[model samples]
Target: MPRPTIEDVAARAGVSRALVSLVLRGSPKVSAGRRAAVLRAAEELGYSPHLMARSLASRTSHVLGVMVSDLHNPFWAEVVDGLDAGARSAGFELVINTGGRSPARERQALTGLLSFRPAGVALLGPVLPASAFTGASAHTPVVLVSRSSRVSTVDTVNDDGRAGSAMAVDHLVSLGHREIAHIDGGNGSQSAPRRTGYVTAMRRHGLTPRVVRGEYTEAAGAAAVRALLSPAPPTAVLAANDLNAVGAISALEEAGLSVPGDVSVVGYDNTWLAALRHVSLTTIDQPRAEMGRLAAEALVHRVRGERVTPARHLLPPRLVVRATTAAPRAMSGL
Candidate 1:
């Protein structure tokens, strides 16, 4: 089937091609009635502008590129939703891509966004180092979500992961947990801060810190749990994120243990995954949508030349207690 074109939409709307173009570009010059007519015509005719062609011709982008580090993680989706809402409200569109949590792929993703020549780019939980991020910022204005930077070129929006981890540890301690183990998010973005927070909080409570090697995956979580169980299993486990915590729960159940009964589990990133009826996992709330909104605002500020200095937003993270965590049970070895 032949795809409908802008000319087709203009004909259907009984307006000139120029008027259609203005309406499609969201020019305020078009009257509300005419704008609605053109929009309806576009909807009826299925006429959408070719992004690359339009961007190339205008040399001005209405598109903001977003590179997500891990699409498998639901946290990024929530953040993108917020970013889309704020961008659309301000007459901008979003083009999204993912890196699948690979540092090399993230560099590729950043390169891909740059190829489109977008007005700005937002990197969500990128695995790339500070240097790679700064390099990308040189090509276009860049706002980073869930990553930090000392470079004045890159803007950053992140939840305080250190405090979030500390809060989880403190809550578990208050619930009578001493033998707590942490499943670290190895090499993942913000992993250092979380690990540091856990270590500091554990020491502050006069408890020995037990760290286990884990990545941001269910398989990694399960494997780490098994390894920890061999060397005297901790009564409570703090996982990297909700997905990891869920995986820990699964591994524990398979090993003949009950959550918050035989062992309590805590997760970071209070995504809807944590709020699931079956999951109900205790986790940290990072205000994902709010961060996205703020990141978009920062990008717009930079794109509009409203701000020269980078907008470094370090929002506070809060702990959300749920059914997955409780006082440790005094149970015998497995």
Candidate 2:
């Protein structure tokens, strides 16, 4: 089939080709009625602007590259939706790729995004070191979501991990759980703050801390539970995230232990997976969509040369209690 062109759109909208061009470029001079007519005509004729051609003519791009840490997680998916909305509203589009939680793969992903020469870039929960981010920011504006940065060139949007973890610990402690265990997000982005918060809250409550080495995955959660079972199992556990929490629950059930009844579990990140009736996980809500929007807005500000200092957005997280957490039962091994 022949592709629709700008001329076709102009003809359909009863406007000149020059008017269509102005509309496509989002010129403020275009009248509201004419712009609407051009847009409606383009939609009906399936006419799309050639991004490369537009970039060559204007010497600028409307593309924002995004690198996601883990595509398999639903949390990142929800965050991307917000970025998409914000970017589109600002006359820009997103090009996204994933790193699968590997430092090597993440470096490759960032390189691929830079190759496109996007207007700006957003990295969601990157596991790469500060050096990698610094290198990337040297080329173009960079925004970090769900991660922190000391680099003056890069902006960051993150939830308060310490406060979130502390909230989980306080909830468990309130439920009469003194022997609560923590399954940490080993080597993952934002893991340190959570661990620190958990430990700090435990000490503040005068309870001994029992932390298990784990990563941000279900397999890690299950393995941590298995390892914790032998040497004085805790009555309640605070998992790294919702996915990890679900995995821990599965392992506990397979070992003939009941959730909340035998061992209460709490998770972080109130993703859709956490809110499922079958899961009903008690977790900390990170406001994923809001975070994404803030990240995109910051990137756009830098792209437009409207901001000089990097933005540091630290959003507060709140605890969402659910069926997964309860008052501790009599401590016992499975």
- Root-mean-square deviation (CA) per prediction: 2.8, 3.2
lDDT of 1: 0.90
**What residue pairs are clashing in model 1?**
none
lDDT of each: 0.90, 0.92
C-alpha TM-score for every candidate? 0.91, 0.89
Which parts of model 2 are misplaced by more than 4 Å? 2-23, 26-45, 331-334
Q: How far off is model 1, as Cα RMSD? A: 2.8
Which regions of candidate 1 are displaced past 4 Å? 7-20, 26-45, 331-334
Score candidate 2 by TM-score against the native: 0.89
- Model 2: per-residue Cα lDDT over 1-334, one tens digit each: 8999989999999999999999998899999999999999999999999876677667798999999999878889989988898999898989999999999999999999988888999999999878998999998999999889989999999999999999999999888899899999998888999999999999999999999999889999999999889866788999999889999999999989899898899999999999999999999999998888888999999999999898999999999999998887753322
Worst 10 residues of 2 by lDDT: 325-334
